[model samples]
Target: MRHRLVTRGAVALCILVAVALIGYGLAQAMTTSHQQTVQGTSENSPHSGDGTKANPRRTRLEVGLDGCTKGWDDPGAGAQVFDIKNTSDRPMDVVLLGTGDKAADPHHDPRKAQIYAELEALGPGVTRSMTTSIEAGHFHFSCMPEDGPVVDGTDTNVPQPSAELASSLPSPVQHAAPATEQELIPYTQQYEEWVKGQLPDIASQADQLKDVIQRRGPNWREEAQSIWLTAHHRYMTLGGAYGAFGDLGDSIDGTAAGLPQGPNDPDFTGFHRIERGLWANESPDDLLPLAQGLSNDLSSLQDQDLAVGALEIGLRTHEVSEDIATQTLSGVDDFGSHSGVDSARAQTEATQKLVEILRPLLADRMPADHLTAIDQRLDAAQKRLDDASAAHPQTAPADLPVPERNAVRSQIGQLSEQLAEVAAVTDIRRAT
Candidate 1:
């Protein structure tokens, strides 16, 4: 009896061990499955690792001839994802706008609306995702087809959150409200007047350049170079009006970058072409016609009505700084004269003037602190350029010490970014 009891006891111990092993295998399998699931989710989610196990609510928005946001239903105020699909035959643009304090109307004018997010050039049958946080407001999507007019989606009214919930919710991104074309007209006119005023001085300098080239004296080359640089700098200060200048602009200051025969192309007849001939030791007589042509172009520019549009004014606020950073600093515009540093200084001055022209409008639309930051960045860039010029006068931009060159580039880059904000704030929006 005692032996039987001991054998049963040993069997019971074996059963317990077997059950323990089985439990361990099940736990391991579950852990592996859970890890695989998480990995798959991370691969598919755009906003993964946002410290949340559940994905943000997603709503599908269909863009068709009928409407821009046909499939959207109010998802209540919270973080959400939009699956924007273009159901039209052509490409389209979609903008989510917050019409502040206004009645929820699908036909509300977008010029007064604050843009929350936008998806541009969404092609037919293609779908894209936009993630954003929504707060209590009157919201709608404006869909613009490449071939048709803009169609607004049905308005979605998100109820205001409780004070406690509002405090915890992430603030939604809101771009500065757009300006109207009428509001921008006065600023454009002012800039056009300023551009016109500079033309006479530029024309006079061009004539001086021609005279210096004609003299062929020992110091003629030096005088011609000085006059050419002065004229070019003055023209560059009219950066805001370059678009309005159109082909005339290319004729005056365009480089030989894209020409078929480069410097020999017939179209390569501008300040750069003259620069190459002067620095290459070509005969003054050979360069006489180019100088004459430049003077004529300036005279013609003076006679024409300088009409700088509102859009160009907004774009130039940033484009001037961009040109300095990309072209001047990179030595792409240096044909032979290596006067990039001087050109950059002229462009910087132009940008400063543009900012001042938009200051009144910007102050009304953007935060004062943001405007101050933009000014500070511009000042920093100007200071860096001044220090470089004072320390190494007439040195080429690329030839400056690496640290100094980098400092200038960095400051200009920052200034460009800030100025881009200005462009966006001042841009005129259209409702059709």
Candidate 2:
């Protein structure tokens, strides 16, 4: 009897081990498969602008189906089927991602923000529809499980689905009380109007700044020197300080949202040209203060934007303010470059003022995570500053020349990028 019992126990243990191994293998397989999909393609799915008003898409967002063609219609609610077919010679899978309550960042937009369904392994011209559903929040549709050009049985560096979409999450909000079309329509329209107002303003500003730098007349040198750096700086800060979350801090499903769409649209190759001109293609040093100022200004502008919409923007104005303050102190300690500290401090002060002016817009909307991240960046910046301070001192605060200037401006540019990424991660207002 003892011998028989031992044999049974051994068998049970073996089964459990086998099961565990299988589960682990599946999880890894899924992860590897997803990565293959992300890095595999650089093409944008074509969007059809031809959907009829008579059958307008009631869905919050429609993916995979074209607005131009009649075959695909918008989804109303619940799980939607997009009949995505890869008529192309290759085989591919469609991976679906959801955005619960997270607002889409205009920059670094969510993967789902793309117009067409995610296509994987399609040969030339083959067509198929992908099926998906809408949550009251944001979502993404991408091609997944791709068996791409492989080497050594390994698909080199294909990116998997981003962290936000890898899981199938339960909807946190009650769908029965979904935000009505009436409420969202007004905000959407308002956003469009606000966006249109800036084109001329941006062009005019860029032109004026460039002329100042070229003339090297009056204060033009200083202004011209800083123009490109400043604009990029401001753009970065505008990007950083906030992001959209799915559940606005309530649900773990919250992921960063859309890329910037209005003046900040990355697709606007024009901005890049404009950006390059601000520096005149020279190195970007004297531009630090200017760029930092821009970050401060842009952050302020976004705060103002939320106020216009009654969007209940979160009150994170001071988070960036505090970050700037903390870094100035550390920079003073480490670099002995009072110049960097002085400049950084001045820009931060502007950021602080912007926060104060826009505190009311935040109301109850901002999430805790957003606030926390800004502080983290500030803390990291301080470390950099402190390290600079403790190093062997340079003879004199060097007047920033082109090459040196470019280096500083590049740092400012990077700083701006961080700010924007944070802002993108935290701008989570929904259709409420």
Candidate 3:
């Protein structure tokens, strides 16, 4: 459902490239301690940046090969701002976690620790800030560099608030302990198998589209369009496995977003390309080749290893709906077919499947009511989509009534927010 094709391998390479760029840029900016204070703001000053009335307490922590959380002292409870500076030559990711009673030493087993906030890809000699409100608890900072093992800062104990202070302090931030790679592997593997199961239907629909194009009988164009929609919808249900498909996916469903020649690019071959040709009144003969190519790609996809990364599986839980709301509903991904809403419905189906697959893992980690709310939100969004499709079978999303479109968007936006927590909870954390 993404505008451009991006694989897990590609994403890793990009991060490595970005780290190299940051190292090169900040080659001369390295310094010792890296501790700098804000001149104007005191620890007790009320900060309105994040719309909270609590005073902002600032602390600096150093991250590098030598140590992580170098200068951190025991911080007090309440609103806090941490300036995490990367002192190493390589880029690093930093996570602020609340260690529950499960682990005596938080760093030794961080998977059980709940994440309050995190900053990713903090470059060398660069200072990145994270603002969060904390309740009295055991907390620590974990720093992971590009090419080294995870390093942890000293455990910080924020004393419990007194009765009077508790009444005045903000509520504790909501967080969940992250899952480990081993814990997530089973779920990812299950999801992978489910994706593999969908391939048969997708390939079959592609074949149907090609057959309709080849017939060219009376009303054949309309029939071809319908078959194309069916095939496209089936392909879209594979939303969570997008990155796993990699370039093959691009060849099957990729849009012409980043292509040099746009839609005219030679590489623009897939469902969208076929959609354009069919809806733009191109000859059936012209579309047959594209349809054949799509079928071939789908067949090829079945043969590949089709492994879904654990991290990517977690991320796709939120991203599938996000792409639907941002790209599919917005019509940015629509070629000439004007089937954005239809595509969104298919993607919603994908989201539902992803949530179902991860429900076992999420049950204990997430609040019961939170999981129920997600289901309710997803059902509400699906009902709206179903109603829209039944009311106007072939209309564009933008051409729909404003109230209908807004209702769908509102439901989807809320759903995306709820799924974001799922992403956070299922994120695989590094353990020492």
Writing each residue's lDDT as its tens digit, candidate 2 over 1-432 gives 000011333323332232232111001111111222222222222333212222212222222211111122222233333434332233444433343333434443232231212223343234444432333334434333234422111111112333454243222211111122343345434433443344345434545554564455666545654554444333323311233211211111111123266323432222232343343543344333333343343334433433222231212322333333333223421222233433343344334333333323222223444334534544554444334434422211233344543443444333433343222222332221
- What is the per-residue lDDT of model 1 for residues 61-167, given as tens digits with 9 covering 90 to 100? 67766776754553456566777666666666677777775574446556677766666567666668766666777887778767688787766677876676556
Pitting candidate 2 against candidate 3, the one with the higher lDDT is: 3
Q: Which lDDT values do the candidates have, in the order given? A: 0.70, 0.32, 0.74
Off by over 4 Å in 2: 1-338, 355-366, 379-418, 421-432
Residue 149 accuracy (lDDT) in model 1? 89
Clashes of 1: 0
**Each candidate structure's count of clashing pairs:** 0, 78, 0
Q: Model 1 — which ten-residue stretch has the worst lDDT?
A: 24-33
Task: Give me the candidate number with maximum lDDT.
Answer: 3
TM-score of each: 0.80, 0.25, 0.78
Candidate 3 structure quality by residue, lDDT tens digits, 1-432: 563433444333333232232111111122233234312211222223321335556776666766667545556777777776676777677878887653374245656677676777777677777766778778877777776898877677788766776677666565667689888899999999999998988888888888888888899899988888888888888888877888898898888988899999989998999989998999987888998999899888889988779877877887787787768888877888888888888889999999999998888677788788889988988899999988977778888999988888888877776776676577676775
Name the weakest run of 10 consecutive residues (lDDT summed) in model 2: 22-31
What lDDT score is found at residue 124 in candidate 1? 67
Which candidate would rank higher by TM-score, 1 or 2?
A: 1
